[model samples]
Target chain A: MPTPILVVDDSVMARKMLIKALPAGWDVEITQAGNGVEALAAYRAGKAEVMFLDLTMPELDGYGVLETLQAEGLNSFVIVVSADIQPLARERVKQLGALAFVKKPVDPAQIEAILREYGIAL
Target chain B: MNDQLLLTPDQRDALQEVTNIAMGQAGAQLAQILEVFVQLSVPRINITESSSIATSILQLVGTPQSVTAVRQAFSGTLRGEAMVVYDQNGCRDLADLMGYEDDIDRDSERELLLDVGNVLVGACLNGIAELLGAKLSFSAPTIMAEDVEVGRLINPQQLTWNYALLVEVHFTLEVRDFTCHLMTLMPEESIVALKSALDAFMENL
Candidate 1:
């Protein structure tokens, strides 16, 4: 079965860039959400075995999604993808249980390396 | 876009996303400087007539109020001016953030605002230029207007351009009351360069 993935962000362009950056060979089923609210709904709908999330968004943000996931003990692997690259932001996301953080203007090779480091099954 | 805007909706969206990433870097710099989380809004781009920019600005500032604004001109693959506007209370909050609690005088307050304008505007413009793979140089930021009504912030006669593309974003302090509107106004000539730069960036992605 292909790994289910969720890419969430308010910007259509951002979502598109992220999708393009995904490992080309990874057998994945991709789902997208415009904000944290939609992301949670999609996750509950089983479309997010692994989630790539953006921080600043309308309706609900990435931090809210991470907090919700932690509160509910949902262990769907989450990798935060955001333009907010502050060290404190990174630390907070890590503390909130994000598996990793990737800065925006997503790099394909970086995404692949991160996936590999996490030992994600492609 | 009465002039039959050169930018399509798709292009506008792409530019806004690019501006978002750039502003994010600027916000992070602020957060680091003040030791407070900075709240960044989604970047909004508007193509407006220079004759009516004041109206757009008044709408942005919301309800006429005394404000301070700083302006810095930049030149490169893109050329334009960056303006940072703050309400009086926001200026006070920024002063408080910098520990200027001892009854800041007029000159001191203006200086403080200019310093902040440099920090936020410089980082944001630099980030955009870097992302677009363009070289940009900025003149020193100067106080454009202080303690003026939003409607009087910019004189139409002083404007050199007929049409401008304004990229606007807001940054708010998470715990403090500081909020500022950062706007980069690109004139007709600069808009052509910006569109091509934006196109090149989108192409790479």
Candidate 2:
């Protein structure tokens, strides 16, 4: 079985773009979560290896989910996919143990670069 | 944020003019992203009660089409919220522009909206930041269904029922079926400073 990857965000469009940007034939099982609560549940259920998370969400945010995941001792890599590219936000997510921070207006090349750098092979 | 109250009238006008220019750049960026010819009306500046913003936005959008809104908060030398509101129908146009298939999933919608909001809002805020010799950082956009009742959009603590200065812009794509509005809000105090800023900018021009 391929590695399970989780995509967490509140917007349907954001998830779609992220999925589309992924390398074809990755043989990865991509799961979706609408919010942090759902992300947590999906993480626990699937033991996902990577998570593409959005920062702002109602009823639990990306940061909260990361903290919870840490508490649970789940070591999945987190890649923040957000429109806001504030240096502080980048630092904050990095401190929280995220693997990468990709700003929005999703660039396929950037996404590919990050995925490859992270060894997320297709 | 508190410093907005201290700005002189001249500073205010310059600020407003700066916002106008900033919005113009943002509009251009939107056109580029969508790969459509966009006609954007010069922004109209108004300082009025927060309750009136929705009405103002509706007036700008015209007709009762469902609105798809994305709001993001920005902070730096100037702190405020920027929002991009598009007609629900525009989604299909955006999807087509991105070359996505017709059967786009929920995830695709979120990503597209985020990109849309980022281009419009980011460009506007960044434009202002550059003009003012300040740095601004934006938060991720939060999508919401436009509440015709403007009361739903206000932050009770920051704006309450007090006045806000609104910079509203209307956008029309040349050949596409997409149409939208961009509204930027700031506290009433900023209006005075913004007006002054505009005046100075004009004098220099």
Which 10 successive residues of model 2 chain A have the least lDDT summed?
A82-91
RMSD of each: 1.6, 20.2
lDDT of 1 by residue, A43-90 (tens): 999999989999988899999999999999967889899888788889
Please give, for residues B1-205, the per-residue lDDT of candidate 1 as tens digits: 5444578776898888888898889998888778898888888888888898999888776789999899999998888899999988988888788888769887888898898889988889888888888999999999998889989998878889888888889998889777899998878988878888878878887
Which candidate should be chosen as best, given TM-score against the real structure? 1
Residue ranges of candidate 1 with Cα displaced over 4 Å: B2-6
Listed for each candidate, the true contacts retained, as a fraction, are 0.64, 0.00
Global lDDT of each model? 0.88, 0.69
lDDT of 2 at B152: 40
Question: Which regions in candidate 2 have their CA more than 4 angstroms from the true location?
Answer: A1-122, B1-17, B146-161, B192-205
Chain A TM-score for each of the predictions? 0.97, 0.92
Error of 1 at B64 (Å): 2.5
Q: Give the 10-residue window scoring lowest on summed lDDT in candidate 2 chain B.
A: B147-156
